[model samples]
Structures are given as C-alpha cells and as structure tokens.
Target: MTEEIKIQAQILTNEVCQFTVDRPILPKRSAFFSQKEDAKGSPLPEALFAIDNVVAVLISGSVVKVTKTNDEQWMPIAKQIGAAIRKQIQSGQPLVAEEDVRRSASEIDLRKKVETILNNEINPLIAQHGGVVSLIDVRGADLYLQLGGGCQGCGMADVTLRQGIEASIRRALPEVEEVLDVTDHAAGTNPFYSPTKK
Candidate 1:
C-alpha cells in the first residue's frame, strides 16, 4: 500500500497559515512569491495563488507558508491550500521553473533586492515611527542592517527589527537566515545605504 502525502496545516497568524508535508515540496532553496504575477513559471505558486485570498506564498523545504487577506476565514481556505499543494505534488512538475532555481545567493543581487524591499515595503511602514533602516552588508546569506533615526535606540527597536523588518526580509528572501542589526544609537549614526542618495 502506498502511503499518501498528508499535509498538516497550522494557522500561524490572522493572515498566515503554515502547511507541512512529509515529502519535500521544494527540496532546494525556498522561494517567496509576492503575487500571482510573480508565479508565472512557478507551478506550485501558480496553483496556490489561484485560491482566492492568497496574497503571498512562501515555499521553504517541506513547509508552505501562505498569507491571505483577513476578510476570509482560514478553515475553508486552508482546505483549498492543502488540496492545491497536493495537486502540485502529485503532478510531479518542478515547483519552480528551471531558470528560476536560486543561485548561490549572489551578494550584488541580494543587496539590490533587499534594498528594494526596504525602500518599498519596510521603510514606509517604519517611517511612521520616525525610523529608518539601511543595509550594512551581505555576508553570505546573512544581512547586516543599521537602524537609524527613532529606531536607533528605541525601546521597541528589537521588536521592530526581529518581528517587522527581519520577518519581512526572511519571508521575501528565504535564503536570508539571519538579519543582524549593527546600529550603535548612542550618537546619531551614518547610514550604510541611504534610500535618498540611491
């Protein structure tokens, strides 16, 4: 008797649900698809995005982390997500396109993408707190960021860094396992990568 692939689902947050399977959905590097447009060549993401309310999909190893709009209940949608993943696995196609397989985490490319994420997604949200984030460097798959302005030495700096900034980065760039904050806030500090200047 062939053991069927079983998916275990856990609701992580209001907008996020994490699913796991016994087999590797993505044996290689993890991938994050921001929207349906980004899922062009990735069949797994394409299928996952087809389910309504799935705003983002992250496939890391045997885990699938999906983010949906808060309007819908996860009970029904979780079933759909599991079904979609099962279909994809049963189909036996590459989760991502051959050309899209992640490379050796290029420093130049990682820097550019991380910078774009900060400029577009992260900084704007944190700016409400009068804070700014800049990339210090990329050492392998690790990121060093300098928190400035209000975030330099705020009481909630750690919360913002780990929960907000790091979560966003790790979600987008699965290869980034560590996001190190190297800001010394005692005095006003210089930014490593200034969004204004770039």
Candidate 2:
C-alpha cells in the first residue's frame, strides 16, 4: 500500500494557489509547465496539467504554485490539486528526469553568477541607501529578485530596479532577458522615501 501524502493548500492570488506536500518534491531547481509539452519528463507537472483548469504548474522548494485559467474560486480546485499531487508523489515517479537535470545544469551556473553579482556589486550600491536585494529564483532567462530594507516600499524602488538593477544585470549577463522585482512594497516596514516621513 502507498503511504498517504498530506498536502496543504494556500491561496496566493485570485487565480493562483500554492500547494505544499509533507515531503520535498523539487528542492534545488524549479520546473515551470505553462503547457503540457513543457512538463515533458516531469511526472508532477504532467499530472497537474491533467487536471481541469490548471493553466500552469510551477514546482519549487517543495511547493507547487498552480495557476488557474480564470478567476475561479480556489477551494474546489485546490482540493483536486491536492489529491492529484498526493497520488503523483505516492507513485514513486521521479520529479525530474536525469536528462532534464543535465539540460538545466547550465541554468544553475547562471543563477550562481547572478547571485555573485548581486552580492558583490548590486547589494553594496543599494546598501548605501540602507537597502539590500536578494536573488529569489531564476526561471529560464528571467531573474526574480526581492528588495528589502529601506528600498522595500520606497517610491524610487521601481526607478532603481528598472534603470539601475535591470541595467546592471543585463550588462553582466546578456543572456538574462529580464530582472523582475517580486518584493511586496505594501508590506514594507521601513521605506527610505515614505511620504509620511517627517
């Protein structure tokens, strides 16, 4: 008998919900399946795409973020997703195939390079403003970052990311097509340029 897999679902947005299982699914690299073809050798994404209304599947750090096609309620869909993920895990299928791992090995190197630039170059520059930047994840040619400290909710955050950070990343790694800021500015505790500041 297959061991029962427990999953917890959390709504991230109106159309996106994150489902986490008790065990680690994908620890190192994240796999994104915007379509069934993208799933390829990954049993998890392929299983997830089989479900109705699951437009995309992103597995990273033991969590699967499922994006629905429309603004449907998450309660009903999340239940189905949770069950599917449980079944998929219990099947003992590989999360990512050996071939796929070899294919994405270069991306790991690229991610490390990006992290080095952030630590050595970008972070120091932002530190002067009482701010810091962190590399969240790298998907394909896109780099996701989170800005913290004084830069979190600052009005100049966008300008800094677009003109300064993005430019710097692009210059360093021309292969990186985009550098996106995933920081939640509204939740920022300390902003360098808050309008309410005296």
By summed lDDT, which 10 consecutive residues of candidate 1 come out lowest? Answer: 189-198
TM-score of each: 0.55, 0.57
The models' CA-based lDDT, in order, is: 0.81, 0.81
lDDT of 2 by residue, 29-117 (tens): 66655567767777777778888888877777688889887767788888888888887777778876656555455656777898898
- RMSD (CA, Å), candidate 1 to true, equals 10.9
Model 1: pairs clashing at backbone N, Cα or C within 3 Å: none
Candidate 1 lDDT over 50-126, as tens digits, reads 99999987777899989999899999999999989888888877877754446322654687799999999999988
Q: Against the hidden true structure, what lDDT does model 1 obtain?
A: 0.81
